[model samples]
Target: MRPPGGFPIVCHCLLLETPRGLCLVDTGFGIGEAAFGALPGYYRPLIRPVLSDAEAAHAQVTALGYDPRDVRDIVVTHLDADHAGGLRDFPWARVHLHAREHAAATRPATSADKGRYRAKQWAHGVDWMTYDDRGGETLFGLSAIRPLCGLPDLALVPLAGHSRGHSGVAVDTGSGWLLHAGDAYWFHGEVASPPHCPRTLALTQRMIATDHRERLENLARLRELPAEVRVFSAHDPRELDLAVS
Candidate 1:
């Protein structure tokens, strides 16, 4: 969806204030200079990642009046460069992802796979937690990771399609359930009842999807989520801003 000004999507990440410690769901383009140079030259122009000092997760944590070091866990939907760039900033945090995603990122077998992940960002040597469980509790019609380690109210809904192990981080936000559907669908309209998206955006989504057919199936299920369970995507600025406010 286009904002009033233009088509700048939000690179929104979640900062969960939990009793144990801070848990982040997906890390935006991290801090420091743009990693566009690290990306495959052909895709650079397409991705056009814009990194800012203040957008760093560490800086954002400090702004929230918490020690950046206090961020002890990172629950990732996938290890795409844009989503995991900030992992370098939180070396002490235990990074978690679906087992398949971890495998794909760590040992990329194909040229396309290698191009999709940036190894430089994870060079910090993270304490990774990869989940291979086939069973978990069900939430909003999807089976979710049960007992997400220390975060009880949070669960990982495996929505693999865009990536081999793409997932949605579901949280009980006191008000109701908030499902962060990370990259399963980019635009909100993809999950709209009728299922629509700008032709350009839709094309981009399909081209990048690891399993295009499965991605569409997942989106159909996402649209059926109960009204009380708030669902949003990583790049939808309107939905992201509304959730923040």
Candidate 2:
């Protein structure tokens, strides 16, 4: 399938306004260009991060008329450099991730693992809150963890495949739930019943997937979710446009 034009691959992040404080779903390319350029030669060109100083996650928070310091919690789908890059911006915020992801990131045992995680992103020290898939309502054949920690109306749905502890962050936004399926699938078509995808995107998914079979299974399940659930992945520009529009 040929991809629709004018939709560049976006490193989208979600900033939520909660009663406790401002909560962020994922931090997109939070680091400076210098730091990103300093990445290892082998992986630097592969990622080719388009980081802008003005576009840092914290700066965007300030632009949105919210104080960066007020952000108290950050719920992540995984710890990939692009997703977790902004962590250092709000050091005071407690970072949440799946326990398995925390382990994989902290102690990378394989070459692929080492390539994806950048140590500099979290070097500022984060108050890490690791969650196990223990409790929550089952939504569409998936574990929907409601009120993770003190986060009301927020749920952590474990859809581990791309990474050991990768998950989707589900938020109840009064009207309905928004499921941020981080890196679960690259293209919107992946979750479509027929599962159509651009050849390049399909290749990239295969290259980065930690478990190809599991990823496919998760995508199939996402397609089965009710329409009101409002599901979208981290990287798909079409999905991002629909959510924000």
Candidate 3:
């Protein structure tokens, strides 16, 4: 489906300079994937990614003057190909994600799950540390799995709907909490009081959603979050611009 005119989507990832080592929240597409077309065939023609090696997370980490090996932990909101494609690039990093997400990607009980996840992205056998919502603290009335893999002030807030076991990574950035709402919503307006998403983008989200009703419910809850808690979507360029600026 064609996107709206002049409305660009982006793959936004967060790089954290933590006490232990560099921590990455959502690794975008990998350099090798871009060069060798590791992504599914339908993705290229539909998404039309820029496919720049420099845009890859590994390259960006290197450009920032840090050794790629220093990236010790990776927190993924989900195991979608675009989100986890950089796993091989940082082979040594411990990957942390929801247990259900890992199972969905690796086992793929449903056809949709099979299509949504790419095995080659994680075929190298990563050191995965999975968490469930059973035992965790609460954040703003939402259940959160905290201290992901022993990293302090980091939590995974379950916000499944776009995909089974999809979640938002919550980071305590010293100043306040910033929630990276991965694929939970596509546009900033989605969490507005009177939520408004572009028709094309809204349709796209609905088409890919594992549970459209639940997704909308989560979006509603996000809108009710306190103003101090910053929330942003994964693919909205406007949100990315606001974040960087």
Q: Which candidate is the best by TM-score?
A: 3
After TM-score superposition, the amount by which residue 20's alpha carbon in candidate 3 deviates from its true location, in angstroms, is 1.6
TM-score for each predicted model, relative to the true structure: 0.93, 0.91, 0.96
- Provide the global lDDT of candidate 3 against the true structure: 0.88
Q: Residue 103 CA error for candidate 3 (Å)?
A: 0.5
Compared with the true structure, the alpha-carbon lDDT of candidate 2 equals 0.81
Regions of candidate 2 where Cα sits further than 4 Å from its true position: 1-7, 36-40
Superposition error at 42 for model 3 (Å): 1.1
Which window of 10 residues has the lowest lDDT sum in candidate 2?
1-10
Cα RMSD to native, each candidate? 2.5, 2.8, 1.5
- lDDT digits (tens) for residues 1-245 of candidate 1: 23223456766799998888999999876777464344456544555555677877889989989998889999999998778888988999998888889999999988878889888889879898877757677787987886677788888888988999898999998989989999988788888868888877787788899999999888888988989998889998878878778
What is the overall TM-score of model 3 with all chains considered together?
A: 0.96
**Candidate 1 lDDT for residue 153:** 85
| Whole-model lDDT, model 1 | 0.83
Better of 2 and 3 by TM-score: 3
